[model samples]
Target: MPKLLLAGAGHAHMAVMAAIPELVAKGHQVTAIGPGERHYYSGMGPGMLGGTYQPEEISFPVRDMVESRGGVFIQDKVARIDPARHVVILDSGHEEPYDVLSCNLGSFVPQGVVACDNQDGANGPGAAVASRSVFPAKPIEQLWKARQRVHELTRDHSIRVGVCGGGPAALEIAGNAWSAGRENGGNGCVVQLFTGGKLLRNMPERVCRLAGKVLRKRGIEVVEGSYVRSVQSGEIHLENGKRYVQDVIFLALGVRPSPVFRASGLEVSEDGGLLVDQCLQSLSHPDIFGGGDCITFVPRPLDKVGVYAVRQNPVLLHNLQAHLEGRSLKAFDPGGAYLLIFNIGGGQGILYKSGVAFGGRAPFWIKDFIDRKFIKKFLPNAPSETH
Candidate 1:
């Protein structure tokens, strides 16, 4: 049997877990390595913040899911990959060799871009610090923990909450934060959204207008052309010389590719993501496959969206199986258009697809249904299914 190693318990890898029984039946031994035992669904993150869902509702225990399907689950962070030797080095200094390897490790927030205070004050007074007041909205689990801190802070004081970034995720975070403040009886909580450029640049103009209207109605200030320079204690300094006082700051800046790829000597994109071809196989190393936020599809540049990652699951699985069987692999076609639904809180959502955009309770319901269906597939008691 061929030993197959899977790295990262991300959305793309979820498909592999769902197909584990089939893979094992075909005489392939599968092993998964990741830092955490649970996989948090980013789709439900905003809903969780808005008090629409509980934490357990948005995540699943990864080990149980993989183990139940007859796969070995290794709970450790992959420190590096030695492509030549087909070995993956764990953070614990242990190495695992494999016949084939697949990576779906998600991205992380770039460090030192926004200075945070060092514990020893070695960086100087008023240095920006990633203390309890600063939150990076990635790695999902950290964001959830930070939300708890935000809840506690708002419970006793009226603080200015600032969110940086103009993407759909940032907009959703702003909306949910506003709703959370209201629900916590902190109506006096001032929410400010700072975008370095136009809001929802990737969406249609009508979508942008709708989002602006919603933010206005929610009393969240929108600051355009305010590129963040650095964060200091209780303040965010912008490149335009405008300073905003925010007791709590949420970084909605989308993630950059994990640095592990570059360190492993894999050919990576300018953004440091592992570069892969249409088949999702590494351009430099044929035996390696990758998808999700960790890979840059070389056939055509793709938006780093969850939809793209989820859509690539089947292709990834097929290619993996084909590679193991010594058969021809199938190319993956990333469709030009995919549904994008932004939960704007208050039981409302904005939906955009192929230049058309709409928002209302109807869209929110549609999004809720889709999210629930996706989560249901991985539930322990749910029937086995693949997206």
Candidate 2:
């Protein structure tokens, strides 16, 4: 009998969990390790913060899903990989050996970039900066706490909310923070977005303009071309020597792959992600595999987004099984242009795909419907049948 160990409960591992019944039936043991009991969907994180959806509505309980399907679930984080010994070291100091290993460890927001100091404030396993009460916008679950903090601050008096970063996640979080501060007996709440460069710097110009227009309409000031140098004591410092103090700040400074690969001395890419071929197998260790934000594709670097993780699901599902059965592996094709939608809160979203972009109530509705449907598949009561 073979043992398969899943490193993290991320988007790429959903299909693998769904196929657990089949794997278990084949005289194999499957175990999944995750830091939390539930895996929050990144797509709906902003909406969750804005109270558009409850926590239960947007997250999949990792334990229930895996256990219900005859798979073992470990509620702990992976600290390091001892690939030479074919063992995984847990944060709790336990070791688990496996015949095959898959890492979907995911990414974290790099706080060092936001703080621009040695503070290393980026979010990993939901930790905050020691010097300041700054929140890094990764690990997804922290957004819920951020919402609570905003609510508490808004109740007594007007609060200033600052969001750093120019990416979509930064925009969504800023808008959601604005929404959270304005509700539940809230007073005046001011929101400001400080981007290092043009907002939506990579997207089409029209998309950037429309998003900025909507944000300003909602009373959220868009501060373009302002690069954050350091953050301390709830004050934002710009590289050009401008400083703005805020009551609350959300760091969306962008994400970097988990440091475990580099720390473990694996053959990592320039970005410190595990280097993998098109087959999604590690270049150095054939027994090791990965998907999602943790692995850098050798053919081309992939953007860290939920869409790629979703696309890699079926490939990992097929390849993992094939590897165990001594069958030929399948290469993962990243496919064509994918859909992108930003939930800017207040029943509004900006959607873009294949060069067609739209904004308004329709886009928000479409985004909500899509997110809900995707989450329904992994619910505890969902059918046990594999696709």
Candidate 3:
């Protein structure tokens, strides 16, 4: 039997894990490695922050699912991938050799861009730069904890919350905070959304306009044409020389691939994502494959959304199986358009797909139902009826 090692229980790996029995029946030994006991669904993350769902509601236990499939479950983060040796080195210093490797390792917030330097003698994650008020939006666990801390500390203060970046993440954070703050009796918290260009610049103009309206109605101050230069001493400094004192800062800047990949020596995209072909296999290493946010499909410049990883599942599994069996692999082609859902907080959502856009409370219900069904399937009590 061919030994296959799957790294990071992200969207793509979860799909493969769900289909593991078929691969096992075909005579392949599979093992999965990742950091958490539960796999958080990125699709519902914004809703999770908005109090629409608890962490348990948005996540499913990966270790349980994998072990049930008779696959090895290593609850550890991969420290490095030594493709040359066909082994994955875990943070615990143990190595797992494999005949084929699938990498679904996701990206984290770029510390260099988010954290503030210890400019004012304050030591923290982003201490090298002049921004003492910088915050990173990733490693969701840390971000969530930090957000809780902010809420606790600013409970009594006249909070001035400033969110940076114009992406979907930034909007989600700003929206969720604004909606939650109102419920907590923290009215007029001075929520501000600052983006260098148009908010949601990459998205359709209509969506951006709708988002701007929602933010404005929720009392969020929107600042455009402003580029952040540096952070200093509880203040946000803009490239245009405007500065503002913010009680809390949230960095919603774009994402980049994990820096550890550089040490792995795998071919990477300009933006630091693993460069992969149509089959999701590493261009430089045949045995290594990647999906999720850490990889970019070379044939298309699609948004690095979780849906891509979802769609890559069958293709990844098929290609990995074929490669192990010495058979030709099939290529994957994503449809021209995909479903886009945005959480606007308070059990509300906006969904867009193929030039059609709709927003209302009903979409939120649909989102919740879909998310919960996914969670149920992987839960320990899911029905045993074979697919």
Which run of 10 residues does model 1 get worst, by summed lDDT? Answer: 121-130
lDDT of each residue in 153-242, candidate 1, tens digit only: 778877688988888888988887777776757544688988899888877899999899888887888898868777766687888898
Could you tell me the lDDT of residue 381 within candidate 3? 49
lDDT of each: 0.84, 0.87, 0.75
* Local distance difference test, candidate 3: 0.75
Candidate 3 lDDT trough over 10 residues, lowest sum: 125-134
Error of 2 at 35 (Å): 0.4
**Candidates ranked by lDDT, best first?**
2, 1, 3
Candidate 3 residue 370 C-alpha distance from true site, Å: 2.9
Most accurate candidate by lDDT = 2
lDDT of 3 at 321: 81
Which pairs clash (backbone N, Cα, C closer than 3 Å) in model 3? 116-126, 116-131, 117-127, 117-129, 118-127, 131-231
The reply for model 1, stretches above 4 Å from the true place, is 122-129, 385-387
TM-score of candidate 3 versus the correct structure, residues matched by position:
0.90
